[model samples]
Target: MGLSGESQAAYHYTTTRCEWEFYIIVTHTSGPTGRRVLSDKHKERRVGDSREMVELITSNPSALGSLVTCDESWIYCYDPETKRQSSQWKQFDFPQTQKGQAEPELFKSGRWHLHQDNAPVHSSILVTNYLTEMGVKAVPHPPYSPDLVPCNFWLFLKLKENLRGSRFEDIEEMKEAVTRVLDIFTLEDYEGACKKWLECYNKCTEVGGSYCKGN
Candidate 1:
């Protein structure tokens, strides 16, 4: 879901051809020890490429604090290590929409910050002003680097796996299912996931993106 307009169109033409929708913001928390692992569902989608999966698992947040990440399709925050509160899930309709219009109180925590690649929506004046007014620090991230954010490769895979082998009767049902699955995460799980990133980072530094696995 994180693509520039041109790349997005190209991606659509080459990939499944599904039109990008709302923006999803996901945040994960780690345990006190900072050790976590991806859920069973996450592992399923990552069966083929351990290296890529590990890179996706690196963007682990601390248990005491929170992490914020988003894309054009959805905006959400979660503690990868802990069960998130129901109020944390937020769905945005469009980039032009007002900030905090859907759920003002969610951003009221004021303790959180956002790290996102500079996408058109993310860099938009309206979005920037809205995030500023909401007391969220939006930090710039490197482009074309999903490995920098563990969730892009790890948590997203888990989310997709959780939705597999099942049919959602409707969109509402799917949303409810997402909430239910997210509620079961714990800090320990997130730390396990973070280890994957460390493995990937070491591998890349040592062998230039060559294959490396943490046995």
Candidate 2:
């Protein structure tokens, strides 16, 4: 979707947050009509580890064929209805390569691709080369396009708000709490969020502004 110049200031401000120091990845499945039907979320542990990322993708083939979207802290691959991992999941990285190897079948399935902003890790040579070799296409997202990613504008804020003023006994306990929250996210919630996302996108497009609200 395109925005008019009149809203450039708001749009630019929204996009700037896409470059924040940290963020998380979230995925949702969409129907043929472009409505989100499912969701699977993941927290990014670190950056610039192509090998680890390849493993993550291979392990979670159920997310394949979903519209994978993320903010600065997370990256997700997900599908709405399919519960089983794709048989082609094993081919994303080559098996014998030293750096990282993906299975050839994973790319051939044409089910997985990266939709990311131009963050340093997303644009790293290692990441790019590995994706290239794996034949996974990266979506051409404009710099600072937070409107294109739902997490920045909606979910993350809600998630943080839910965690506000809460204390955890330790990192492990915090992690468990976060996991429980994420696990309880029903498909209906994801679809509702996507509907809101489409509304925001339309509003931004109509006003020529970025779709993000300042934090």
Candidate 3:
């Protein structure tokens, strides 16, 4: 019922693949999720040249939609934009399609909320005020608590586990593997991740905002 984004490194060399940045929002099975990709620039050696590849990927509307879940909610990649434009897009254009869907409870725009970490880009005054004006609620995230975040606790861990020690001939091959993993992720998998997320949140709170030590 909420949206959030995170970055993961897709390695290029050494037979493994980790990219620079990937942003995702986790929600109920039938809701829209937003994803953003950022290029990884490294000083040592290049992982993969994503500039051209990204340009092509972003240009295709289908590419964006393909990132969605089984419910067919559209996921898009956005470029850097002015705060005003970003606000307008999020408030108006983003939720336009879901205006009348009634079959799935989660697809109802009224039930959707946004959850993201306290990064400056997400927590800026302009962004906060815009969300407030648009009536989008945000899920509170405690600082430095990755264990409580769905992507960190569930998505990324599972993703990396699947990618671990595997060799990819090229960036495209690596990407295909990543896509395969996502494509096969079942609704039950997403639900289980969210379930564990709630458990972790409760665990963190029970420890009085300190690290949750196992019982």
Candidate 4:
């Protein structure tokens, strides 16, 4: 299976009645074909302003963890000192929801193969070394191929269908709504995605890795 992270920009009304930029990190988890949803993780925080995100990311994109959902009720808290790529991968070790808890962190062992996209952070020497240390194997991804990315073809579109034209009063409200969307996905839904992914993959391979013209 592949692990990928994408950023989404959303707007929310603030206490002062001004709109602010809410940046979220959407982690897509899917089967090997990049179809169907194994699970989805979201990390978000309100930036000082829309422009501030540019500066913040320029300085250190990893700092986005500091804004990650801190409430125990949420899956993962962005801990600057303790959190990093390792912790993100570790979340898969726990059951999605167990004993009425959401994303409870109980360490369990299992074999999970991961393919990460070529983001600067994902490809960095630090991240690669950490993944090697943690025994996670990296799947090679072709450069300049957005269509080959599963999230672009399926996951994000489905998410947009739910979130399009919706408005949130605050970041928390938006988080809750997104959480519901992620948790409500059914196994069959993911299975369908997996099937679609294979179909797309075969088409791409048939063309010798050139972009396919059809949906």
lDDT of 4 at 98: 20
User: Which sections of candidate 2 miss by over 4 Å?
Assistant: 1-65, 74-109, 209-215
* Per-residue lDDT of model 1, residues 117-213, tens digit only: 5556667888889877877765434334455455555656566444444444444444555555544545665656555645644554454333234
Off by over 4 Å in 1: 1-64, 72-109, 195-215
lDDT of 2 by residue, 23-110 (tens): 3322222112122221211111111122333344446755423335555432112212232432223222212212232334533467
lDDT of 4: 0.39
Give the lowest summed-lDDT range of ten residues in model 4. Answer: 13-22
Relative to the true structure, how large is the alpha-carbon lDDT of every model? 0.42, 0.42, 0.41, 0.39
Which parts of model 4 have CA positions greater than 4 angstroms off? 1-107
Model 3 clashing residue pairs (backbone): 9-18, 9-19, 10-18, 10-19, 11-17, 11-18
Candidates 2 and 4, the one with greater TM-score: 4
TM-score of each: 0.46, 0.49, 0.47, 0.51
- Give the candidate number with the greatest TM-score: 4
